[model samples]
Target: MYQKENSSWVKHADFTICDMLCLQLAFILAYWIKNGVGHPYETELYRNVAVVMIFIQLVCTFFNESFSGVLRRNMLEELKKTFEQCTLVCLLVLVYMFLMRVGSDYSRMILLVSYVFYIGFSYCSRQMLKKFLKNRRYEEGEKRSMLIVTVSSNAKNIVETIRKNNYGTYHLAGIVLMDCDKKGKTIEGIPVVAGSEDIISYIHKNWVDEVFFAVPKEITIPEQIIKDCSTMGVVIHMQLATMKSLGKNQIVEEVAGYTVLSSSIRIVTPRQMFIKRTMDIVGGLVGCLFTGIVALFLVPAIKIKSPGPAFFSQVRVGKNGRPFKIYKFRSMYMDAEERKKELMKQNNVKDGMMFKMDDDPRIIKGVGHFIRKTSLDEFPQFWNILKGDMSLVGTRPPTVDEWEKYELHHRKRLAIRPGLTGMWQVSGRSDITDFEEVVELDTKYISEWCLKLDVEILFKTVMVVFMGSGAK
Candidate 1:
């Protein structure tokens, strides 16, 4: 049941609300300054523009990851970032007004002045809020208490790192030096409260919300300590090796009645997974609507030219080796599968774990060129996404044969569900000739996944499609 702490957006949700209020106040004040003491909401044109501004600002905040590390940012960095976000929002507002043909009906000065006021108001509010939180949020008994268990050699470093990184979440209660008798001594100003012999007794006497075990390689950690901590209802964290050795993302979970250490580049909280699925559902519905429209035109062309059903379905490997039937518009002839073996020698990729080529002959001559160039062939994957067999953004699913040939490290791409469009598709798939390069991009996406990153990828996907860098 263990999961990551709150995401930045969830943690600073109040701050997001505060930002909206600041925008409202600043815009109202600007409207008064521009139009003799009246409000923007009173007018239809200005009121509509104001609503658009709010929507654009929310998108900017979420996609730009504006609130990330806000607590740690110094005043200058905060000021710069705040101004940049405000400016970007203003530019987007201008773009929207122009597209809607409402720019001429509005006072441009209102936007300029609103930006000015928003910068000052937001910066001051954030600084004040951060100061209050840093000073008062976890003062006295509000902070959760943590106990540390490590050898004397590693005690000071661990204590310092915890104190430095944890904002107001934890109060270091005490330390237990297993390899030495350092009772009543202090490391980084935290007292050594107990030795190994009296650890369980100390927990019984004092309140400890968590215990972190950073046992050294030479030290033999007692199995009784972990059981005792669990019995006492205290969260236990066994700190593993350096990030270089064990990878960045790590998790602890009960597997088949055994506690095991799992390391990958895609550790996630249940909340994050829920949000990702929500995005998939919303996007899937919209994509399916578009797919239905495209099928009306493209399906007839395929049937006229190719001599089979207009849809194609193949069993593709999904997340964690699960197989699912992936749907696609039938762009190739019925014997396309039989022809793939003959085309293997012509693969454009080196060390071809993946198959690709120029001017694939199995493609229906005129209709295939038009649909594949327009990426109309991929529309049916929206159904796969809706069925929960794929995501809107993830690694490309491989065929059953391709999956069987995957090396140990190459299988890491399947850590998450495959997608309709992914890092490989957007980042110059046609230009890339190395199969390893595709794996690298997918691994990078898995390691650094966030909702904001997903938004960014979707935007990039749009640009890639519009610019004629269509799917292969």
Candidate 2:
């Protein structure tokens, strides 16, 4: 997470704002240069047209990663990207003009001249801005600090590799020796300040930006130590000779020519994620409208039958181990939680990490069975999604007690936000009683995720809900 923020290609909001400003100015300047001052400025009309044109170009720029190259360092690459963006922007505007049958309203010569000025000015502005930022960072004495974790035997090779590909982004601050007697030794001018046993304390006391684990194959780092770094929000890099141990889901990224495996739970593209969130917002609003109507009858029915609150909420673990209340319409008796302990032995799940029973005595008679079958009890969760506590499709949230019993590997499923419905809900949920199988399915959904997959699962869920195939 920290590395993502410090990446050289990460675009800045100021840079984007300046980029748009430069493009707009270039358009006006081109108009004046081509048609002379005799032509009316059309300030209002042209400004509006420029705004719409810039918006389209921004979309095209993002898709093409036009702003993803280091400006001052990669002038040639930046030039190429600038040309590509300019050509794409022109093509899109032409397509729009043709589609709207307004091609004759705009002058083709002005566009051609504007493209030339836009490309030239954009590249020059970026280069100047890059120099300004470089001077500022130099004056402030800011440099990305790195702490290398390796044995004395391989420290030289790691240091050399870093030097070869560093690209002026990182400078070694210190080294933590692993399985070595050289605690006070120096490796390539950097002092080996601590051994494996004292590494955690060193990390806590030092201002380390990144920790690179470059140990030998046989020497395994403790899982708790890794988790500690993650909890501290420090970026970690692990260099491996082979990818056999790390799962295939890992993405291999090169840093200064050194290859390392990087893993993330949300592997889908940013555009897809944005669309998913938009869908969730839209779906949540619609669901809440339906909930308002359903509550008219549900509130009366549930209260008259069970003599308790019409809704139920429980503490559930969300993404990154945060806790939040998950709301649901009352589908069980008021004493359901109290009676759960006595019914523990009745749990049907084989490798039990969760409790489930086909004929639980706690349910609120007819209303419970009907709502559970129809999935109407889950309607209240739309509020959770709208509040950003959950998603429209993700792994089901685990209860507090269930989370407490989780093993180290079991927590992998918590990397993403919990969802109202997911692969488990649509895929014979009641028939599957093994906790391990549930984890497998959740992991599979994350690894194979895409916008289309979410839509497909949602469609299957509607069918399952209507048929009452997977509810108990």
Give the number of the best model, judged by lDDT.
Answer: 1
Q: How well is each residue in 1-472 modelled by candidate 2, as lDDT tens digits?
A: 5635543224455566667877777787778877785433466545556766888877765554456545434778778767877777878877877886777777777778888888898888888887666544321236677899987788899898886556467768788888875777788888888888888888899888899999888888999889998888788988765665555557767979886777665465576678789989999999999999999999999998999899999999999799999999999999999999999999988756988998889998999999999999999999999999999898899999999989887887888888888888788777889888888888888878876678888899889988999788
Off by over 4 Å in 2: 1-262
Please give, for residues 304-405, the per-residue lDDT of candidate 1 as tens digits.
897889999999999999999999998899999999998999999787688889989999999998888888898999989999999999999999988988
Clashing pairs for model 1 are none
Error of 2 at 173 (Å): 35
Instruction: State the RMSD for candidate 2.
Output: 12.5
Cα deviation of 276 in candidate 1 (Å)?
Answer: 3.4
TM-score of each: 0.75, 0.51
lDDT of each: 0.87, 0.81
List RMSD in Å for every model shown: 5.2, 12.5
TM-score (C-alpha, index-matched) for candidate 1: 0.75
Q: After superposition, how far is residue 56 of candidate 1 from its true place, in Å?
A: 9.3
